[model samples]
Target: MEKPQRGIQSIEVGGRLLTTLAEVGEPMTLKDLAQQSDMPAAKAHPYLVSFGKLGLVEQDAASSRYELGPLALQLGLACLRRLNPVRLGTHAATALAEELHQTVALAVWGNAGPTIVHIEESSHPIHINMRTGTVMSLFKTATGRVFAAYLPDKVIEHYIDTASHHSFAYPKSDLRPSWKAMQKTLKEIRAHGMAQVVSEPLPGINALSAPVFDHEGHLALVITVLGPTALFDPALDGDNAGALRACCAELSHRLGYAPE
Candidate 1:
């Protein structure tokens, strides 16, 4: 492995104070900030003074508490502005496909519905009708269900109304016959942080999907992985499901999502 590059020790230590403030999400006194950073108040004061001059942090005159300054807000906004969920999710899905040896796809809420934007096929790709731009069923496919679970009721209801006029291959069974029943299903999906389908959308195929949220806690995209049922484990507690959730969680974190 290549040797790691050296860095300044003082700057790293000072950064800890800023990180603590961000995590605490509140103004903190110098002593409290020092304690949280595991440094002495005297040692941390100089860094705080330097940070205030740099506009990375500011102190309230009355409360005498330190918090992130305008510069910090600017930095955060800049980062959020550059984030492209689809681009980032596509890269993550590609790596996930390689790790799990299953086909992975990225879906976003399109004008029509949950539309697949990218697909990363496994070494032994499964033969399926799905491709980029294929809009999935809101109530049937795992991908669409994930969006339904997180999206507003109005959006889902609108799609359901449109589907009524057109044949979307909705199963005749009591999949979501009533609004109450649909809410219950959505509740379960939200609780589990994912949705799964076994041999329904396509016979002999199993799939699982999880949502990626932005910093605002809004659904940014959904990542779905599918494979032949015989080869894929669809259990919620299974290894495949665990890996899929982990992938989504990491992506969500990158998007600045902090789960409550």
Candidate 2:
């Protein structure tokens, strides 16, 4: 009554076909894969078809190509929900927004970059409208830059390369030579555990962002408060710098970070 002993080896050619095709970042024509993998078109056909059906890969009609599929998203989201970093963030964001009379956003690094999937907007009309689910680049934004600044150089470099090719409506000066400002920004972020952008990326908008380090001490998310310049008090250190640092520390603590 033993099982058939299922494994990737059960597939044609022992899953070598699947491994090779899955590694291709962009879609590739079946013909191209057959040629590259040294497998005949007839032999490769079933693997692509079976893998695509399982959602491990996808096929494009116009080009007759295959690439990774949404199943990865399905799995990743399941993991994130179990981790529930957002739940920890939710309570903190609400409390802080109420206390400060400003907006609170919980952003996570994602495909489009730091997306604000949760937001509590200010009641006043003269407030910044950073709505939920708003996505941005990893460089030219407070939420985005804060995450990029805190992440390791490997992560930063990958995002920078991706961001450079990404399409966005901003001045070239804002993004020229991507790493130029990263080191300086990272120093500020590491020292204060947060980063600030004033009247930047847009007029009249100011933001303070802090890293939400996970239990493993890696940045898992970022909490950012943004508003019009008039709403922010330009003084915390007995000076503006001190006050901003305090804000960063406060947000970091709300995420369970005990500063040393």
Best by TM-score, which number?
Answer: 1
Instruction: Please give, for residues 1-260, the per-residue lDDT of candidate 2 as tens digits.
Output: 98787666456472665556645546788888777777898888887788778887788888778776788547645755566677767876777777677677888877766788788776643444457777755666778778877777787667655565666423445454458657787677667666677787778877777777753467778887777887664232323344435544564554444444
Error of 2 at 167 (Å): 5.3
How well does candidate 1 score on lDDT at residue 163? 55
Check candidate 1 and list the clashing pairs. Answer: none
Alpha carbon deviation, residue 22, candidate 2 (Å): 43
TM-score to native of every candidate shown: 0.92, 0.57
TM-score of candidate 2 on Cα atoms, chains taken together: 0.57
- Determine which window of 10 residues in candidate 2 has minimal summed lDDT: 234-243
In model 1, the runs with Cα more than 4 Å from the true position are: 163-176
Task: List, residue by residue over 194-233, the lDDT tens digit for candidate 1.
Answer: 9999997799999999999999999999999999988999
